[model samples]
Target: MGRFLLAIGAPPDRASDMWKRFEESGAMRLAVELEGVQLWSSVDLPLSIEPGGSRMILGQVRSRSLGDDDHPSGILPQHEQWPSWPKLIEAFWGPWLGIEYKHRSLRLELVRSADIEMPCYYALAAGGIYAASDADLLVAAGACTGEIDRAALASALVYPAHRPSSTVLAGITELEPGRRLEWTPGRLRGHALWNPWDFALPPAQIHDLQIAAETVRDAVLIAVRGCSAGQRVILGMSGGLDSSIVAAALRATGAQWSGVTTVSAEPAGDERYYARCVAEHLQVQLAEVPDNIERIDLRQCHAAHLPRPNSRSFSQSADKSMLEIAAASGAKAYLHGGGGDNVFAMLDSVRPVLDRALDTSGWAASQTVCDIARMTGRSVVDVALRAGRLALRHGRDAPRIGNSAFLSQSVLETAEFPHHPWLDTPPGARPGKVLHVNWLIGIQNFLEGHAGQGDLPYRAPLMAQPVIEACLRVPTWMWCTGGRNRAVARLAFEAMLPAQIMTRSAKGTPTSFLYDILEAKRDEAREMLLEGNLASLGCLDRDKVEAALGAVQRLMSGDVLALMRLIDTESWIRARIARQRD
Candidate 1:
């Protein structure tokens, strides 16, 4: 991913002077300078400028329309195509950031697409707007006040995956994905380019699992082909259906690629059986890296340089091993089936049954209830009763943005947890659809990180826009059809997959490895949490934290997960402070 730093509306003098600052310490080189805009990019990707500069695109990008070539982040769509800004911006993908200069009403409006596939952040500081693909880049450039947003950090401990658009730094705000940010002289506003709810509603719903299968099948292929972009692809194979589909797509594109599966010491985390199946079936090279529990250092913060803490102790080995393989093989990015479960609506609640009953006649929906039963391993009577209650409520209620009372009452009382932008639903929205949209929210963190050039950045083609939109358009119940979760996805690629993968139901996870991290590093975790930076900032409850870690115990009551988040966040705070000192 090409790194970029953009300053919009800065004073002429500051814009000119910032060059020395970047040259001295920043990660990007100066790329563009307009009347009020100055852009810096890591790579000198050619600037796509409109004649005489009425419109322009700076930095590298890959579009759905042109996946084979990655450049020329599109010119603004004609009036006939997109009537809004976010819609105009949403077509591009990647943490590789870009800024489009579009002229409107004699005013220059530059909108950065920060949703779904791309990561963008903006802060109005020193009487101007500063934006960057990496948040720490902006901080390093002195574009932000550098004051930590403590409440935001506290909220992250409670809800890491769906943290609000605001960043931990007080002055910077992350641009929400699938939305547009509008900046005028002294004010800012937001507009959504698109949303999952649009397809979940009645008008866009598709009942045919067959059509849904075909749609996702094609979209994933296009996404993977485009993402491969002639670079040697490295597949993080888990031997699960999701990663298998990624392998199938790579084979279809005839791209140069290989696979790696992380094998855990414990049997539960071992999926080499299935990983072998995929590599042999497709006739591609495969590697197995040990998920070495001993390698996890609770103290090492590899992502400490990032704007937020992304390092989970258990993922450290897998991440490091992948990087080694990438360096050895000359791969720039790692592809996985990251969002397949969420996109395919593999949820635990009876929400799908509720949605099916509401969308189909009773006789037509009866079979779906049976399917839900088998898919979730619950009885038909229980599933129907839960779905019936959900229908009576017309699907308005929602679970809390996050759940964990790990924080002190003082923190919880004043925290003001943020709601997801999409949660503010329109009237008559289905409860199941709301939950479906939320499931998408849950997997977002998996797709993001500080993707440095040296790092083998993670890519999720299954979570691509067209692929997600296709899955969203299908009726939620359809995923649970045939007594299996993600049934549509299974059917979509059944012809391409080995029979074993097509029928495998037990997906692998690293929960056991995570527990191992906590157990092995119990003292380290206790010391970090009991007297760490977060407690000093009033983000953690010392008593509760001490009690949780004070005992050497099993992973119970989600306490271990909560404690790990605190440890991760604390490490990050220390790293951020240390960076400031440097």
Candidate 2:
């Protein structure tokens, strides 16, 4: 919810010059430069910053926080916590450092937790290394070459949305989620901590659903206990299982809560009935904001609040509408049902996992392989063998077939590469044996993607670490549909939820307004796609670009997805260009 920028290599005397670039940008909150590695935090809060040799560090200490006196960790011990930050820096930097700190005993270079919880960016350049919280701030520091990366462009154009940290700009790599990088002279060191092996199952244990659900409910309640008393907590009620579960958890916590929904007013997309059911179940008040763009003047607001690349799910008009509701709601934090799909369903990335899960005969495995082969435009049996090889390479015991093409890729990438400290598995464990591990991967991916973005403190009780750890330990019959087929979440929700809410389907599906944006503004959308400053950004495949846009035009009028894909691509490209110009 806050942005901070730190730049090393400036002379102690001219530190003010470096601070000016980030502080004056309006995007940052408080920008400070200090001598001997400054540690700055509210005196009452346990959080702080300090110096370790040449690098700076930041972190928080567990103590009673000032915001909520009832909270056990009341306030951070600033000076003491400062030393702990350097210990974190060392984790990212590895060895080769003489340590220094603002606080002597705490040792910022060598003490404390691994959760740095700070949004930071860094780049290695000829002069030295530069670090900041925002990508734009990095550009302003003169460390960036101002050239867009073509690979990122290809990813955005071909994939659904631009993945986090992987922007459409060239030579500019984001520190991947859960990872950090350090620079010293001619070297750069990096490390990621979100390992799935951390949550690996014991040799003879299986999780129980009833007990696991209660444990999940408890963790969510514990999180709610930290909320400031007398504050109204907001839930982004989508009438879906994830959000409903979160709302129920808040109710169970006995906290003051409210529900908010952004209804597109396009047919049945309005979540009033399900949201009301949730509210009534919790006995809480509900507020509904129709997705009406004309009611709020987007043009004026965009200029006033967002003069750069502002990407919204729908048109700028819908963006303005949502902002208005948030402002009016007086809610500081919102709970979301965001990660249910990744954890519950096989999702779009099932094929790879399926290829690894099946125990079919050589002939059947060959057929499965052929299916994958044909999908990728290769020979059937040959592709089947290739699929088996890929499964073996990824350490899957059996391969599942007929899963979603996109999600299958996710499983392949995630299974192949370890992202968390806990994701480490035995060398020969088959893919089918690691369903719980895959669930953890999906959870990590969700947190890194959604919770890390925008202005909301989007909480996911269902994806809570303990929830997923427990889910993985339970039977696969409760989570996957086709051994990887479909509707795993739907079945589980039905068992736990009220019948009306349980039977309801559809979540976050953009309604008719999305198609309306295209139908009413096709010319405008085309102009932005073809003639806007974004088109000339030079990193995207011009042919793929044209093909996607042309496809958008020929698609059915109600295909909100196609329209969104087109607009998101355009917006991403436009934002990159705008950032470059800035």
TM-score to native of every candidate shown: 0.91, 0.67
Q: How badly does each model clash, as a count of residue pairs?
A: 1, 61
Write the residue-wise lDDT of candidate 1 on 64-152 in tens digits. Answer: 55344434233333243332444444555443333454434213344544335556777777767787776676776577756667777
Which ranges in model 2 have alpha carbons more than 4 Å from their true place? 11-14, 22-46, 49-118, 160-167, 180-182, 200-205, 223-231, 293-310, 315-322, 345-475, 480-497, 503-508, 533-563
State candidate 2's TM-score. Answer: 0.67
C-alpha root-mean-square deviation, candidate 2: 8.6
Task: Give the lowest summed-lDDT range of ten residues in model 1.
Answer: 74-83
